[model samples]
Target chain A: MSYTTDPARIERNWRAITIELDSPRPGRLERMLQRLGLPTDVSRLVVATPALRRSWFVALGLSMLIGLLATDAAKPRDDLFVLLLIAPLVPTLGVAMAYGSNADPAHEVGLATPMSGLRLVLTRAAAVLGFSAAFLALISLLAPSAPAMAFGWLIPSFGLCSATVAAMTFMAPRRAATVAGTLWVLGVLIARGAGDDPLAAFTVVGQVLMAVVAVVGLVVAVQRRDRFDLLAVR
Target chain B: MTNSEIDAVGQADQEDRALVARIARRDRSALEQLYRRHAHWMTPRLESRCGDPDLVDMAIQDTFVSVWKSAKKYRGDGAVGAWLWGIAIRRLIDQMRKKRPTSVDLQAVGGLEHAMAFEDTLIDNGTHGSLGVALRQLDPDLRAVLIATAIDGLTTKEAARLLGVPQGTVKTRLMRARQHLQETLA
Candidate 1:
């Protein structure tokens, strides 16, 4: 074979010709990442969540403050108990908003992604839970509440959020949230009216029940996780 | 290959490996750099085989996306370019599987003219002879295996994986392709 017809030369020429075309436009990669709502910063590897917006957190924080002020104005004597019962509702709502179909605009794309829907839910839920916990802890410290009341809302918050997520598997997220919130409020009111301790829901027995509820909710949520993906397409 | 050619290929391999490492660390810039460096050539090469520019573009996008997600899994055993090709080819196959036969434009498919023109230039310059003609005369399957092994420099196992065929089949096809090309050239 002649030098020009050598297979190596031919391969080299072919590779050169193929690459002779223009490069893709500048920022195309950036644009694609943005379209996928991926973070440009390499270190920020967590998936983006629409529900964890600044406004949502602000609203949650504001609601907690309003709940505190209301309890202080209505019954200044036992404010800490009222605050614990109510404060967790805010973050419970956050968890509800973070994972459900109603809140995530990118739900369809997220479902199609290799990252399982359950994983996305769990990651975002954990973040929301952590943020809410910190926010409530700060509020408890600021309030004139006893030290024991500082973490009183923690158990009920987990229970409500878990139940909401579990209910979401079988029904729409908004409805699930509404039902869970209503039941929590009614339970608190009933306990108060029955001459029981206003903070009975946060009692040891109550905590154990809520803990059971949380565990059951989580199991149901896992078993029905695929429903989240299917619901997104719908 | 000439010493200079060997050096150039070696340099590219090193750069690609570095880029893969950065990508594994979730560096978006590295992903973009890898895309800009390869997409130009990859587009045309993939387009030549599939004939659909849209499908080629999809394959390119998916190739990078896969790289972004799985760069950590890269063992650095082979050329990064080959790994990219492996991903691109598999993505193209996936696109082909999803596309209905009637939807594909026959005219856009598998035009080796660009390659032929390059070979013609080489032949005219006395660098090669009728090797291009012999290559064009082979069956498309045989031609693909030959180009993958001989030109792309993939191992028989790699080529088989890329082509979705058994390694024994790739070896047999390669041997047959070589015998045919030698007879035709002679």
Candidate 2:
């Protein structure tokens, strides 16, 4: 038989009978409730405590505790010490790395309204770091003795994280960024320990160095402009 | 019927009806029961879309999880199976996004192949013994459009997006697909 592209035929075929699943088949309710940590009976409350939120809380609490301990240990030079110690709390970079890796190729292209990958990364990083810094600033204010001036580190720290994530994203193998970021932080901590003066713990030079590192990151990110595959490599 | 036999049938129906009600209420267990009953069929179906058994299973699992989460929103509009298929389609798309084709050509061919494969399987399972042979004989484009829009219940727009075609092309292809199917079945 000959085939034709008639509109009526298309409509007829397009609307097919919906299939029945014979669903909620048998014992599925118990299994799913068990999986979701919900109650089996419909009468009971099913509060879905997302596991991701729980993990985020754990990460936040741990970082705060680390911040408080670092402040207490270096009381007079609290600002410098806390910035150095909690430098790795620059989680926005990690988030950017994860976000870049997870983005689909179609999205990597096609969404052209003038936003570059670097711009997207920097914007998101700024938002996350800004909120984090604000939270830290509040904590410092409440404690009274804690140095709130360390909040200045937020700007460079954000830039550094964005740059590092952007550069690492361009390099082949996405996980390499995670590895490089981890090693870089570890190396910085080690270098600080090797230095002699106790007050040297809060040196402005170290913060400036990180600030420079962050700026360099942005420059590297800008250089990779049209390399969507590298920038969005999974 | 014997007393024991009557009780067994009544119990099974009671369980089925209860599950359907729970599904209507967005009960996760009811969804799980649905999964257990249909997963065997869904596994092969998704494997055709994704080309990996493991990926298909993961997609299917995620599909059920989504179904469970969205159960409270169930409006009892159509049969529960249609709703489940809708969820499954979304899950498959999500998985495809995770590890997608590296090139436009690969993506297009992959899309065409997935649709054609699904149609072949459905026809084989359609209870009409010769339907699979007829489906296999159709052109890949025709096969893909028919399976995606008709058997799968995706809108013409959705079918076009998945097939990497314009909506108008999808409509035309679908008409061609129906004429072929009707002629073959008749």
Highest-lDDT candidate: 1
RMSD of 2: 17.1
Chain A TM-score vs. truth, each candidate: 0.74, 0.55
What is the C-alpha lDDT profile of model 2 across A7-106, one tens digit per residue?
A: 4422322221111233443354336645665434321111111111335545775776566655655354554555544544445443443334353234
Which number leads on DockQ? 1
A88 in model 1: Cα distance from truth in Å?
2.2
Candidate no. 2 TM-score: 0.38
Work out candidate 1's RMSD over C-alphas.
13.0
Where is the poorest 10-residue window by lDDT in model 1 chain B? B110-119
Docking class of 2: incorrect
Q: What is the C-alpha local distance difference test score of each model? A: 0.71, 0.55
Candidate 2: segments with Cα more than 4 A from true spot: A1-129, A132-234, B1-17, B23-29, B101-137, B160-172, B175-186
**lDDT computed for candidate 1:** 0.71
Q: What TM-scores do the predictions have? A: 0.45, 0.38
